[model samples]
Target: MEITTLASTWPAALTDPSGRRQLKPRTKGRTMVIDKGIGLHAFTDLLATSGEYIDIIKFGFGTSPLYPLPVLKNKIELAANQGITVIPGGTLLEAAVRLDMVPGFFRQVLALGFTGVEVSDGTINLSRGLRNDLIKDAKSLGLTVFTEYGKKLFGSRIDVDDFANTAEQDWSCGAELVTVEARESGKGVGLFDERGDCRDDDLSHIRSVIPNLSRVLWEAPLKEQQVSLIKTLGPDVHLGNIPVHDVITLESMRRGLRSDTFELQQVPFLEYMI
Candidate 1:
């Protein structure tokens, strides 16, 4: 069968049982994948296969500098062609801040064709003024700015008031969204406890503070974290730090195509089975 015909034959209800926002250029239900050094071919395959489900691609934790200039440019071009916003990991920006090389960093990032920039202080101490300045700087360059809230320390947790204040200031300074740090391990940091489980009370408190949940992208690299967030926040929650291989799986969960989220359909047992 032809590819278009094959796609046409699939029932929409079966494919997207949860009534998710399926199209891109999405303000909500965005997924940001973290690239921690996948080869060019794998990266190509990822965009080819699951680009529709991805809204942003983050070159995780300074890995953008590790790629050859040509290779990095090619990757950025590919993602941009698919309407995906690409950004270097925030750690690299933090490094530039520490070295007082902010101008050079922004210059190279624009030269590299990155469509966006992440301003974060995960491993560094950034005063409120500096943070706002970084956000404004990226915005001035016509790059989409994504700021990060919370620290990356092993036992760090989000203080509700601080998070609210940071997110508010970030938006005021022109950040499109602020991401919560859950690290790649999804354990012992930010919203998750040492066992990689979501702190329900904390999550609830944070949710209460932010009326528009889409403004906060929660980094959930683990399956359990993804499931928990989906269950708690509904299917349209923005998620980040997703592993490349799990893109399709995460999409499945978002659309209720997987058992973990199948009940999101709210269909009767017999009707679903049939």
Candidate 2:
């Protein structure tokens, strides 16, 4: 499928500060936004303004079932048409797993026009075998599968060995990416400290064990966290759980348009040679 990027209308004098924020269909530097009950009009407005910068739109948590059927369907359809993948929050799948409704989950997902599924165990105990099956099942139905690591509980931290093992297994099972959970609040969870700051030691540990960083998506909902990850990992790191309104802001930071990363690129020449 041909992904259409917004025209690069600006002059060549302005280069991305990081020097390599590729346009979609991009395999790296992906941003996944979270939709917390946004209406149809607002959803459409967001897509119209910044859809190209977004890779996925997750209907946050269990809120996916709360939307009117038509609104939900339209939102998924719009995202798919714009080349953006759409999936229900991982918590929804957890609910299905708990209730033994995995089949229904996939059926409803496809019936609703969602292009992806997030198989997560943040709130439930999913055996590794089950997790693998879920990933494969989603792939068999032609959905892009995104499995997640980390628990949703407060103060939960990632286990490097377990995470590395699970990530490899998930990939072998055909999952596209593995998201590290940060919940909606990015504090005291996963790689974040109590104050929403990143735990660099933990991040480095994870990186050391994982062979490929490109397959992992860190959920950084806060601007500071996003900036920190972009600076530490370069702009190609895949990030998730971004709020809808912050799409352009995150993209700006990715391209070094913001002060936090303005030094990422060489200084622009003051003398224009027209």
Report the number of the highest-TM-score candidate: 1
- Whole-model lDDT, candidate 2? 0.91
Which prediction has the highest lDDT against the true structure? 1
Q: Residues 1-274, candidate 1: write the lDDT tens digits.
A: 5454445467777777776665879987899999999888999999999999999999999888889999999999999999999999999999999999999999999998999999999999999999989999899999999999878999999999899998999999999989999999999999999999999999999878887787899999999999999999988899999999999999999888898988888464674554
Residue pairs in steric clash, candidate 1? Answer: none
Alpha-carbon RMSD of each model: 2.8, 5.2
Off by over 4 Å in 2: 1-8, 13-17, 268-274
Could you give me the TM-score of model 2 versus the true structure? 0.93
In candidate 2, what residue range of length 10 has the lowest lDDT sum? 10-19
